[model samples]
Target: MKKIRYVFYMPVWRKGQWKDNFIGYGIAIWTFALNCWKPKMWKYIRKHFFSHVEMWFPDEDGKFITMTPEIDLEPFAINSVPQFTGQCFSSTMRDAQGVRFALASEVLRNPRRWWYIEATVTDTRYELMLLLAKRQEGKPYDKWGLFTGFFMLAPYLQNDDERYCSDVCAWLAWMANILPKRLWIISPRRFAWLLVKNLNRELKPLVKGKYNGKIQKHSRISRCVQIR
Candidate 1:
């Protein structure tokens, strides 16, 4: 079992042409999914410039692993399901520029300009265990939650039948007491910003240095969260 030290990966893209862009347009699609087609969400997406976010952890063998929900393409249907994948360092650009294998430590250095935040969750092993065990196959994607969330109509629309990337992360955060049970929920962008912001306020800065090259360990930050 892993101790649940986590890192987040966020991709950024440079502009050129439609076909040339992946991260940029990818964000558009994801943000639309997150916000339920809310026109105002575009402003927030543009403001943050983040398209996708994935959770990472170090395995027993010290290899970095990623857990995120992805669209499962089928013959006539598609769905989103949680998947465990290997570490990939690429911009998803036209040519997959700057792709490489990066360790959890090197992510903070951000050679590709990705964002990273670290925190230790109490009993993360148990949380991850529960997540894996409780995962049900054919769990429908919460596509309707998008519309409900966008219109601010009914928060009850989010069902237990499906799993979304941020929804799963947010649920774990709540279980760990890092977040509270309340009216407003969190999206991937919001969860990323909130968790990092909260940890920065509570923990001491452990490492800071100048930007070097790719795969270089730039900064290492640590903080402990008291799970209630």
Candidate 2:
């Protein structure tokens, strides 16, 4: 089996685009409000541009498989379940753009700074992640956890049946011994920061001028889709 690596999907906002949106405004407000007490947190918020993250593994067929939580309100859970059965580096959903496997590493091509991690994962660790994903399949998305995480100022909010995007990601990492602790009530952005800080100390920014040879070589998603 191909070694599994974690892929962090950043939100792609055009230049000068975020300044006009609610997300931009909200981030700004939070930065201003918590910068003093949470300087590290503020720095993390400022550094990350992408809004989402997911796990990827190479399947038995040699094709890469991606797993992430999809928001589903009807059953009030992360309904897509494992989200494990698809082409690697492909788009998560049909309508979304800039989300394909091609773009997974493609974001690094841009001039703006982005974060991506590639670690040599063991077969046991990979299977652990799969088991955790199986348990979380069809779980509810924890909207309240998202709110209370911030409100209560604790990531470890009440653990119930539901889970939000970051909550599940954080949980899986903790369970698999990837993340050090249960960083309860976390956001995707914060989770990204924590992963880099806690796990990989050698993490570096993807600068504009540098050639992306590492990604091209390591990101052997599949032969059917040429990376270039």
Candidate 3:
């Protein structure tokens, strides 16, 4: 018999829950259920529950902030419509004006669409991963890499300069020695699944209402656990 460890899932909107619960470096995976354009495409193409991923870490002040590779079309397009022309840019999760102080506040606007898993790593590794992610800020989003790696089944086509959502997450895991370098090309859903599997825990939702999406058969979705 083996002992199982659990990774508790809680609502991101709940006040003080983030600071009280997640005190380590973690990764958050978002779903397309919110009617977002990019997420909808990811949901349709990947057919997975999670479409995008982002990394979160506490700043020097101990307030958590999210870092992700997003497609910003403002620089290249006339309208705000997102397209392949949008380059990948590393930035903190922010609003239209690009002001973001903490991850909890941002997710509070739509808590149901997000869930996070704390990575099990040493403090040294966490620092290294954070540094690696910071260096990726302002990098171009890998449009061709997304096409060839996921659609064309040729991950080697991906260049070192630009990266997609999951590519950046996978790269961080690889840099921290948590995952092998060979598994560089990965989908957001696949990466989350791997984390859950590696942690040997099931996702126990803390809030009520349905959150499960089109997950694979092997993926486990436990009943909601009320936090009193």
Candidate that would win on lDDT: 2
For candidate 2, the 10 contiguous residues with the lowest summed lDDT are: 90-99
Write the residue-wise lDDT of candidate 3 on 73-164 in tens digits.
76853322111111111222223112111333333223344555655677778667666766776666665665453344555677767776
Q: Per-residue alpha-carbon lDDT of model 1 for 68-180, expressed as tens digits?
A: 33333566544332222323222122232222234444444342434445555655654553454245323544555533555565467676565444565556556666566
Candidate 2 per-residue lDDT, tens place, 1-228, comes to: 345445554444456665434443443344234333666766666655544455554556644334344555887876322222322232222223322233333323332334445455566876787676766665555545545644654445556476555566667778777787886655666776677777665434433343433332333222222221
Q: What C-alpha root-mean-square deviation, in Å, does candidate 3 show against the real structure?
A: 16.8
Off by over 4 Å in 3: 1-48, 59-104, 150-153, 204-228
lDDT of 1 at 57: 47
Show the lowest summed lDDT stretch of 10 residues, model 3.
80-89
Top candidate on TM-score is: 2
The per-model lDDT (C-alpha) reads: 0.44, 0.49, 0.44
